[model samples]
Target: MNIREYRAFFLDTLSKAYDAAEAESLFYICLEELKGWKKVDLAMNSNAELDRVELVKWNEVLTQLEQERPIQYIFGNAHFYGLEFFVDENTLIPRPETEELVEWIINENKGKKDIKILDIGTGSGCIAITLAKNLPQAKVYAIDVSKDALAKARGNAVRNEADVTFIEKDILVADSLPESFDVIVSNPPYVRNLEKQEIKNNVLQYEPHLALFVDDNDPLLFYRKIAKLGDRSLTGNGKIYFEINQYLGPQTVTMLQEEGYKNVILKKDIYGNDRMVSCDV
Candidate 1:
C-alpha cells in the first residue's frame, strides 16, 4: 500500500483500541522505527511504498499493539532524560516522573564536585546512569535484586558511556551500605498488589511484576527498607530521593521522617500530584 493508504489503515485499526492522537503517535513511532521516515517524510511523499519485508515486520508490530502491548517494549528501547536505553519485559519502563527526580538531583547539585550517588532497584539503570552522564564528576552505583534486571542496567550503562557500578544485592536485608554516599535515590516498587485491578492490561500483563508490585498489606515495604538503608548509607550531609506512590505520599514522607531523616520534602510531579520525596540525613 502507498504511504497515505497505509497510514489511514493503521490509524483506523488502532483507533478502536487507542485514541486518535495516540494512534497517530504510534503510527509515526513505528514508521520511524521501521523505515527511518517521519510524519513529514510521509506527508511529503504520499505515494511512498513499503518494501514487502518491511511491510511484514510493520504488520507484526501493529498486531502486538492491537493486542495491547506497550510500544516501548515492542520497540525494545525508550528515551529517558535525553538518553536512549534498552528495555524489556524484565525491566520496568522508565517513567517521566522519575526523570523529574533525576532533574531535581541534577539541578540541586549543578556545580557540586565529586559526588557519590546510589540508585536502588536500578532497572534499566536510568536513574544512576543519567546521574553519571549529567554529572561527569559523580560516582554512581546501582543495585538490583534480579540478575536479569542488572544485566539490562549494565547494558544501558555501557551504551550511554555512563560509568556506574552495578551490584546484585537486595535492599530489604541491608542495614548499611558498603560505604556512605552523597546522594541516594530509588524508584522502587510501590504499587500495591491490590491495585492491580486499576492497572491497565498493557502494564499488568507485560511489565515485570517484581519491579512494579508491592504487598497490598504493606505497600510501604520498599519505602521502609530503603529509608532505613538511607539512614545508614547516607553521608553526614547526604540526601535521599525517591519516586513515590502518589496515593501514599504522606505515608512515604512519614516513613522517612520516622526513620530519622530530616528536612524531608514531598514534591509533586508536573501534573501537580504528589510524586517524589527528598530527605536529608
Candidate 2:
C-alpha cells in the first residue's frame, strides 16, 4: 500500500477508538518510527510505497492502538523531562504534571552544592534520573516497592547515562530513608477509589494499579507516611515535594502544615489544576 492510502485508513480506523487529534498524532508517530519519515518527508513522498514487511508492522501498531494501548507502552518507552524511559505494565507512564514537580525541584535546588535527593515510589526513575542528569553535583537515590519496577528504573538510569542508586523497598513499611536528604520527592499513589471512574479505560486497564490508587478511607496514606518519614529523614532546611491529586491539593497542603512542615505551597499545573505541593521540614 502507498503511504497516503495507509495514512487515511489509519486515521479513519483509529479515530473510532481515540479522538481525532490523538489519532492524527499517532499516525505521524508511527510514520516516523516505521518509515523514518518525518512530516516533511510524508508530505513530499506521500506516494511512497510500503513493502509487505512495513505494511505488516503498521497493521500491528494499528491493532494495538485500536485496543486503547498507550502509545508509549506499545513503543516500550515514554518521553519525560527530555529523556526517554522504558515503561511496562509494572510502571505507570510518566505524566507532564510530574515534569512540573521535577522542574520546581531542579529550579529550587540546582544551585546547592553536594546535595542529596531521594525519590520515593520511583516508578520508571524518571524524576530521579532526570534530576541526576540535570544536577551533576547531587547524589540521587530512588526506591520502589516493586522489584520489577526497580529493575526497569535502574535500566532507565543507565540508559539515560544518569548516576542513580535504586533500592527495592516499600516506603510505607520502612522506618526511615537510608540517609537524610536535602530533598525528598514523590508522585505516589494518590488517586482515590472513588476517582476510578474518572480514569480512562486505557489507563485503568493497562497501567499498574499498585502505582495508581489509594483506598477511599485513607487517600492520604502515602503522603502521611512520607511526611512522617521526612520528619527524621530530611535535613534541616530540607524540602519535600509531591505531585498530588488535583482535588486534594488544599487538603494535602493542610496535612503537611499540620505535620509541622513550613512554607507549604500548593502549586498548579499548566492546566491550572492544583497538582503539586512542596514544604520545608
What TM-score against the true fold does each predicted structure earn?
0.97, 0.99
Q: Per-residue lDDT tens digits of candidate 1, residues 1-281?
A: 88788889899999888999989999989989988887788889989887798789988999999999999999999999999999999999998999999999999988888889999999999999999999998889999999999999999999999899999998888767767899989999989977888899889999999999988889989888877777777888899898988899999888888898899999999999899999999
**lDDT tens digits by residue: candidate 2, 172-225:** 899978998999999999899999999998999999999999998989999999
Clashes per candidate (backbone, < 3 Å) = 0, 0
Q: Which of the numbered candidates is closest to the native, going by highest lDDT?
A: 2
Q: Candidate 1's error at 85, in angstroms?
A: 0.3
Best candidate per TM-score, number?
Answer: 2
